[model samples]
Target chain A: MRTSFKPLAAGVGGVAAALLLWQAASGARAAGGSLPSVGSVATDLGALAGSPDFWSALAQTVGIALLGLAASGLGGIVVGILVGSFEPVRYATRAALEFLKPIPPIVILPLVVLILGPTGQMSWFLVFLGCLLPIVMQTVDGVHSTDPVARDTARSYGMKPVEILVRIVLPSAMPYIGTAMRVSAPAALIITVVAGLLGGGPGLGQSLYLAQAGGDYPTLYALVIVLGILGLLFQLGTRVAERRLLHWHESYREVAH
Target chain B: MDKLMNKRPVLWLLGIGTPALLLAAWWLASAGSTDTFFPPLADIVDRFRALWLFDHFGSDVLVSLRNLVLGYAIAALAAVAVGFVTALAAPVRWAVDPLIHFLRGIPPVALVPIFISLMGFGPEMRVASIALAAFFPTFIATVDGLRAVDRGLLDVAQVYRLSRRDRVVAVLLPAASPQIFSGLQVSLQTAFVVMIASEMLGPSRGIGAMTLLAQQSFMISDMWSGILLLGVIGFAANFLFDLVRRKVLAWYIGSRRLARAS
Candidate 1:
């Protein structure tokens, strides 16, 4: 526990130094610029914390992110399981997935806005596309990496493919699936916010966009701080989940201390 | 029978069938819609040809490619240098690791407004944004890679009385190459996405800006064309990098196979 304090202190010190640098730069720009000083940004953050709109915006943002993540998680797992179980399906879908995967879903925001208009649905759609590939790819890889001996033993016991998948393959793949979720969660948030920023819907991203458009530097800074905190929380939550779920895995076991 | 079932024809159909089916379905769903919301696939293809293949969209694509390459190069160089320095010095790593991790956690998209404010609406801003986005992943990967070098190899180098620089080049770098390459691949994809996002928000040339302009004008077909171009650009970059990785890391692949076999 004492050892942990060192890391925490180092982290806080680094952030403090960065903040000092930012404040000094902003102060220098005070001669003539739209930049807000660190103090003003903190004040703005306080004002935002006191406001109902901030909470509502944050709730909306998190709601969209979670919804999108849940949908993509389900869709990706189902598709990944199908592809993993059936070689024909995997081969058939490989080209399509490869073709679609690298294309940034943000590029399709325009097409989505044209079709669905700027709505929560459009934001979800963007998030779904962005989050889907990483999860599916990881799932497929995980299933492929399932122990051959375990699979053979399960088959020898006359287990049906579905039973084998659910009981054996899934348990083995849980660690990788958790990793996939951890990876996709941040992506889901980022894409959701980006979709909102591009006028998809009302969320923290849209608030940031509006602040930028209005040239309200303090609000923009405050919103950014909010986004950062949200990201940090989600990352911390995922790290905790990973440790709990993957304690048996060698990688996690090695890092446990 | 199994061999016949796995013939080239079947493989070809398996590879190409799904996208073709999806495209056909899209065509059928939007057939004869003239509200410009859903143009026919034919019209979109025509628009793609006219705008991207035979006109100024080529230049915009080139501009984006140039920025991506320059930004990635600068980021790769800087990250490797800094990562090496930090990896060599425990105190420096402790001092800098927190800052790097925090920035890495902050989504690159969140920095666009701040970047714009600081750097103004110029190419410098765009390049800097892309460079910053690429830096953290590459730097983190490099540090990890350096640390992951085999302790036995370092011991051997020490026994051979190799200098620090010699040990890094002869033992550490070769071992770390694969992980570094993986990081670079991720950075490449991320840099492209960041470039497009920044271009869409500001400035006036790039596939992203073109898409934004087309959307604002309500040219749905043109917008699709821009998107198609971006997808192609992304695919080409990935393919190109894969080729380069294969060439550079041929020995790494061989070693991986040996490890798997054992």
Candidate 2:
């Protein structure tokens, strides 16, 4: 207990020191005085916390991200299973998936923004695209990696194909799906933010851009802090959710021991 | 069963056929297009040929590439340097761990506004944003890689009375290179995305800026062509990075292959 407490105390001290350093730097005119003092930014953040507009913008961003992820999660798992179960389809799509996987979502940002007119729809579509391929790929890998021996044994036992799929394949693939979702969640949020920042779409990103344009440095700085904290929450949320969902898996079981 | 997939000819056919078929279908479908937003692929190709063949190539494409490469290089070097010190010093690690994790969570694109606020709309702003955004992944990877180095190997170096520089160069770096390279790949991707975001938000000079401008002005074909160029560049950059990673890590891969075989 004492040993663990030391690290926690050190972490808190570190954060305090960083705040102090930022305050000093701002006073010293770091980056030619554009940097806002930490105190002023925090005060502005407090003000923003009470604004209805700020809450709505935050909702828009979070809504786009969650809806995008949920859609992609459902679509990817279904498609991945269908493709992975069939040899021909898997081979046929492998090359195309590889080619498309590395292309960043930003490549299509302009086209979507143009078509959708910088709406929440545009942000949602971009986030969906950004998160879809990875989930599909991971799910496919998970399905493909199911133990052949278990499958063969099930076949010899005269188990129905549907039964085997439900009893064996899905359980085996759960960990992979969990991991893919964990990675995709943050990516979904980031894409939504980019849609706002660059495409004039609706979200906190647009708010940040407006503040910067208005020379509301305090508000801009405050919004950035909000975004940073929001991002941290998304990451932590997914990680905890993954662990909880995969508690029955061997990796977590070993940790329990 | 899966043998058909292993044949070189089948692999090549699928690889070449899929993209060609998709493009052919798109071309046919969009032909005689009346929709203002959806231009025919033929017109897009023509615009792509004119605008990107050499016209805006120097002005936009090269500028974006220069910024990306320079920023990525700066980030990779700085992260590795800082990572070494942080990994070696317990006090530094304790102080920085929570802060690092928090900063890493902030999406790279979100940093652009802060940078724009500081530096305004300039080339320096773009590069600075790209570099800072690209730094975290490599820094975390480097620290992990260095810390995970085998204690036995360090002991061996100590017994051999090796100089500190030699110990790091010979014993530490090669062992850590694989993880570092993976982090570099992520950093490059982050840098590329941030590069596009910064340009789109800015002084309007690079490929991204031009692309956004063309779309806003309703030059639909030109916009399509810009999107096409970006896709191609993104694909090519990844392919090139993979080639480099493969060449650099050939020895590590060979050993792993041997271990698996045994």
Candidate 3:
């Protein structure tokens, strides 16, 4: 429960030690191959920061991820609410959803490429499909977890289905929605990169794949570092949003901090 | 009459209707397009039958599944062992947490080229890639499961003077099973995804490679068939996991049912 400095220090130390080992291994490999030293990778990382291509790719990656996430978030919430509310709908749809949900959308890249022609459009489609099911399922679970009393009361008050959904159901499901967003955000990024790698789009993923193919260790390492940073940023942002939005929820309450 | 009116068929219709409608719309929209991109639904189905089922596309599916299972099993075993040791020791947990987080944050796909360069174009490299993909989720889940064990339960064990091994096996393992199972579900999904991606990039035998080959040959329908097969496999894995979960965690399911009834 406690986030003490000692544990933090220990965790950092562990990471450093792992990196040290990696560096040593790379050094040994350097004798026979083009292994970039840690310092050289750091320099490449700095150079990447200033490069127009890197910035463009970063922009493209972030743009696709955000767009796909937005689409999924909106579509998922709507479909999830519909599924959660109507029992007949839920019963009828459960099997189909189960059948469809687990299928990795990444496998359809070639199909998407065939249809959409390996464009940014295909990239967006891939990322959107990758993140959709999780977000939708989480939203449905959230909606289902809402207080039975509140739902009944709204029904008794002659609240229209749409009204109850927007006012009563959605508000209650915010926590779950937030959690879904947090989970899906990383997924969106990863899928976007994968799309780029496979479809030859201008993103961090494509750059990394190209660098790897070109055997540019320094650039590959640099790109990997950047990807890690982006992931960290997403996690931190999600935590901040979750705390601010769901402060009243029991799950978000600080433990006498 | 009212009871008959509320039959399961009505429920089934409700669920299938929307997706069916969607598919119909898709078929209609793409009906006129003779382009390779928008192959009609009928064409895809025909292709699916010819390429995947009737023509015996078993080798590709088997290869991918074999890699997925072997890699996931290895990763699950190793991660569970390492995660348990770390969980049992606060020092180890603290020491390794950051490293785990760092590695986990880096998407497994990013490591494909590295694995290829290191291990070359072989099953070993594919297995390693899948293992890397599976390891983090399982490790994190195991740690979470261990941490989430009720302290009061541990206290009870201590009062009963249970051996450390007994405490872990009897008390901790059952309590952690749900979380561990969730991790397994996630790891399995991840392994399959990574398997396809790795094969697409490097190898020549799995579903991913088949998709790539179909693309290169301009066999759009064959590519669609491969994609459809992958989807079916993914769905089957998830459905099977759910069935296993129901059986293994019957107590959990029973409790839920009781709560709902009350």
Cα RMSD, each candidate: 2.9, 2.1, 3.2
- Angstrom error at residue A243, model 3: 2.6
| C-alpha positional error of residue A86 in candidate 1 after TM-score superposition, expressed in Å | 1.5
Candidate 2: CAPRI quality band: medium
TM-scores of the models, in the given order? 0.91, 0.95, 0.90
Per lDDT, the best of the predicted structures is 2
**Stretches of candidate 2 exceeding 4 Å from the true structure:** A1-13, A255-257, B1-12
Residue A60 lDDT in model 2? 98
Scored by Cα lDDT, where does model 1 land? 0.83
Q: Which window of 10 residues has the lowest lDDT sum in candidate 3 chain A?
A: A30-39
lDDT, residue A3, model 3: 68
Model 3 interface RMSD, one decimal: 2.5
Report per-candidate DockQ: 0.54, 0.67, 0.56
Residues B1-262 of candidate 1 have per-residue lDDT tens digits of 8786667577678778878888899888777778667788788888988887778656787778788889899998998888889998876777787777667777778788777877777878788888988887788899999999888988899899999899878888888888888888888888988888888885568878888899989888899888888888888888899999999999989888999999
Error of 1 at A228 (Å): 2.0
